[model samples]
Target: MRFAKQKRHRKTIKRFCACFGFREPFKVLCDGTFVHHLVANHLADTTVSNTLGAPVQLFTTRCVIEELKSLGSSHAKSFRASCRDYKLARCDHEEKESALNCIIKIIGDNNPDHFFVATQDIDLREKCRKIPGVPVLYGLRNALFLEKLSKFQDEYLKAAEDERSRMTDSEFKLLHKRLKNTHGLKDLSTAKNGSDDEDLLLQSPVNRPLRKMDTKDTVQFKRKKAKGPNPLSCKKKKSTSNSGPNVRKTDETGNDAKRSRSRKRKRTHTAKTSNDGATN
Candidate 1:
C-alpha cells in the first residue's frame, strides 16, 4: 500500500516537472505554518526530499521567518535550529507583511519561478491551485504528499499540447512563400523599385483579393527518364575482327587450332624392339 502511494506521488511530481520545467534539487518554498508543523511533529527536513524522491532545496521568505519569531521562544528556537541551513528568499518588502500575502504576491498568477509550495495553510494551498505551474505539498500525520494538478494547471497543459501539435515555424514560412507566389505578389523586402508593389505592401495580407492559382504555381514532380541497363548484370558482347578478310581468316585459323577434333594415339617403339629380338 505504501509503495502504491509513493508511486502516485512520484507521478504527480513528474507531471509538474514536465509542464513547468522543474530541474534537479527542486526548490520548495516553506511557509510559517509548514515550519511550525515540522517543528511540532518532530519531522526531519529530509522528509520533503524523501517524499518527492528527489534532491530538494528548502527556501523561506523573510516574512515567514519573521512570523515564526513571533510564535514564542520554544517554537522559534527549535524551528530556527532545524532550518538554519535553509536559503532565505528575498521578498523585497520594506516592512514585514503577512506570510500569506507575501507569498501570494511573489507567486503572482503564473508562478514563473517554478516553486513547489510546502504549506499547511488551506487558504494558501487553495490560492496556489488557481495559479498555473505551482505544485503544492502538504503533510498528513507523518506522511508527506505532493498535491495533484488543479483544473487550471490541467487546462494550461492541454492548451500547450494543442499549440505544439500545430504547424512549426518552418512550415509556416513555406506556406507564406507559396501563398505569395500563388497570388503573384512581389516580396515586400524587394519591392523598393516599384511604386505599385510598395503600395500593395502597405495593405494587409487579408485585404488582398483571392484569385485562382496558376498551374505553374503548383508544385510539379520531375518526370523519370529512361535508364541504361546495369553493367554488372549484363553479359559482355563478342568482339568482331575489324582489319578485313585476312584478320577474320587468321582468327578462324586460331579458333580451329584451339578446337580438339579427336583423341591422338601415343607413338610406340614396339617395332624396333621386335626387330632387335629377332636379330638376337
Candidate 2:
C-alpha cells in the first residue's frame, strides 16, 4: 500500500513538472493586483496554480503586498492563505535598490544572453531599451493584445450563433446591415476587394498637393547665417582721432594744456603747504 502511494505521488509530481515545460522553474514577479485578483476569484487561483504547478515561486515587493492588503480584509486573508502553499518572497528596500541598479548597469552591457526585464511603466521600458542586452517586455501591450483577442473571439462566436439562428426576413436584413456597417469590417472589405479607385483618389494630385522639393542651394538660402566673420573679409580702417571726423572739437590742445597747467599749480601749492607745515 505504501509503495503504491509513493508511486502515485511521484507520478503526480512528474505530471506537475511536465506542465511547466520542464524548464527552469518560473518565479512569478507579480504586483499586488495579481494576488488580489487570484484571491477574489477561486477559479482564477485554481487556473494560476494549475498553470504554474509546483516549484513555481511568487516574488513580490513589499509595496505590492501592502497594496493587496489594502484591497480589503477578505482579500488580504485569502491572499495570505494562498501564499502559504508557494515559495513566497518579498522584495525589501535593498532588493528593490539592487534591482534598479541592475537595470541601470545592464543597459549598454551588451550581453546577448542577459535576462530581459519586464515592466508596465513606459519610463522604465524606455530606460531598459537604453541598455544593449536588456529587452523590456511591456505588460500593457500583452494585456491589450489579449483583450483585443478576447473581444474578437466573442464577436466571432456571436456572429456564428446569429447566422445559425432562424430569423424573420426583416431581422436577417437588419443583421446583414449591422455587419456591413461594422466599424473596421467595411474598410477591411473595401481594401480586400482591390478597389484602388479610393486609394487613387486619396493619392491624386488634386487631393494631395505636390510638394516642390527644394534643391541644396535653395535649402542653403533658407538656413540661418553662420555666426563667424565671413571668409571673404573686409579690413576696417583705424580712426586716428579720439572723436569721429564728423564731430566738432572745441580748443582741442589749448584746453588740454590749460587743465594740465592748473593741475600742476594745484599740486605745487599743496606740496609747498605740506613742506611749510613739516618745517613748523
Candidate 3:
C-alpha cells in the first residue's frame, strides 16, 4: 500500500511539473511532521498541485534532525521520500539553545528576505515574529481544517441516510440509546465532574499551622546572636579611603603643590638656559 502511495505521488509531481511552470525555489522551514503530511496528501491526489508549485527548501536544527531520525525506519523513509531535491540546512549546532532559536538564526543569516516557515508551534510563531521578513504558517491548522471538512461530508451523508430511511420514533430512540451507550456520555460526564471537583480541592490550601522545630532539643543548634556590625563594613571602609576625603586631600594639596613648584622650577631653568645660550 505504501509503495503504491509513493508511486502515485511521483506521478502527481510529474504531472504538476508538466502543468505549471516550475516554481522559483523558496526557502521553506519544515519539521518532520509537516513533511510527513505533505507526502501523504500528495500521494492521495488531494493536495492542490497549484499550491505545491513553490519549491520547498527544508531548514531544521541538528536536534530536530535527530528527532526525525528517532521515529524509526518507515517514518524516516517517508520523511526523506516527501522531500525530493529539498536541500537540508542546519544552523550552528552549539550556539542554539532550542530548535526554534536555531531556525531563527538560520533564517536571519541565510535569507533575511521574507520566506515561509511551516509549523504549528506557538513558540516558533513568537520567535519568527522577531525576524524582519519571515512568515510562519500553522501547518496543523491546515491539516485539521481538511479533516473537519471531511467529517462534515460524512455528517452530510449520515443526514441523507436518516432522511431516506425515515426512521420511526421507536427506531430513533433505539439508535440514540445505542449511540449514548457507545459514547459513554453519562459515565464520562460524571467522571469529568468528579475530576474537576478533585482539581478544585487540590487548588484550595489547608489552613494548618506550621509545626515549630525545638532548636533547644537539637544537638546541631547554636543560638543566633544579635546581628552586630555590618559584614560589609570592611568594603565600605576601603571604598571610603580610596574615594572620599583621602582622595580629595591628595588632589587639593599634595599633588597640586608639587605640580606648581615643578612648573616654576622648569620656567627658571629655561630662562637661565636661554640667557647662557645668548651670551655664548
Top lDDT hit? 1
Please give the lDDT score for candidate 2: 0.42
Cα lDDT listed for each candidate: 0.78, 0.42, 0.48
Question: Which of candidates 1 and 3 is the stronger one according to lDDT?
Answer: 1
Candidate 3 Cα errors over 4 Å, as ranges: 1-23, 40-49, 52-62, 82-85, 94-98, 109-113, 140-280
Sort by lDDT, best first: what order? 1, 3, 2
Kindly provide the TM-score of model 2 when superposed on the true structure, using C-alpha atoms: 0.26
lDDT of 3 by residue, 184-276 (tens): 665434553446433432331232122234687557957998887877775545343344332434365447522223234434444356456
What is candidate 3's CA lDDT for residue 58?
52
Cα TM-score per model: 0.62, 0.26, 0.33
How does model 3 fare in lDDT?
0.48
Estimate the TM-score for candidate 3: 0.33
Q: What's the true lDDT of residue 217 in model 2?
A: 31
- For 47-165, candidate 2 gives per-residue lDDT tens digits of 43343333444444444455555668767664585456433343324543433443344333542323334334455555555443332332321121001112333454455445444
